[model samples]
Target: MQRTADRLLREPLDCYDDGAIEEGDLSVIRLALEQFHHAVADRRAVIGTGSTDIPPMQARQT
Candidate 1:
């Protein structure tokens, strides 16, 4: 979970260089945002603040 958060919140910075972003970087950013949204939804459900329709994110096996 922590790994996922780090990837979503921090890793994207690596995609930037000299204040410019590339197409591949945009794809990475999109995926990270989508995963982050799922994480938030999962947390909300766990705390009874959201519906269960949103499936929980699976931890990646590193």
Candidate 2:
């Protein structure tokens, strides 16, 4: 899911014209991405540390 979100964000938006997207639809996309990343981060906060002995801060810094 995180990989999917990353790919979605990394994708080029220039393929679509500015006028092609409605303002409300753009907001929904932004909100979905925000929620997806947050959900991934929240899961990682728990899952990441348990699988490894590394501390969260230290693991991130490295």
Q: Write the per-residue lDDT of candidate 1 for residues 1-62, one digit (tens) a residue.
A: 65766666554455454345554665666576677677877888889985646555453332
User: Positional deviation of 58 in candidate 1, in angstroms?
Assistant: 24
TM-score of each: 0.46, 0.49
Error of 2 at 49 (Å): 4.7
Off by over 4 Å in 2: 6-18, 49-62
Clashing pairs in 2: none
Residue 55 deviation, candidate 1, in Å? 14
Misplaced by over 4 Å in model 1 are 1-19, 51-62
Worst 10 residues of 2 by lDDT: 53-62
Candidate lDDT (C-alpha), each? 0.61, 0.51
Superposed Cα deviation of residue 20, candidate 1 (Å):
2.3
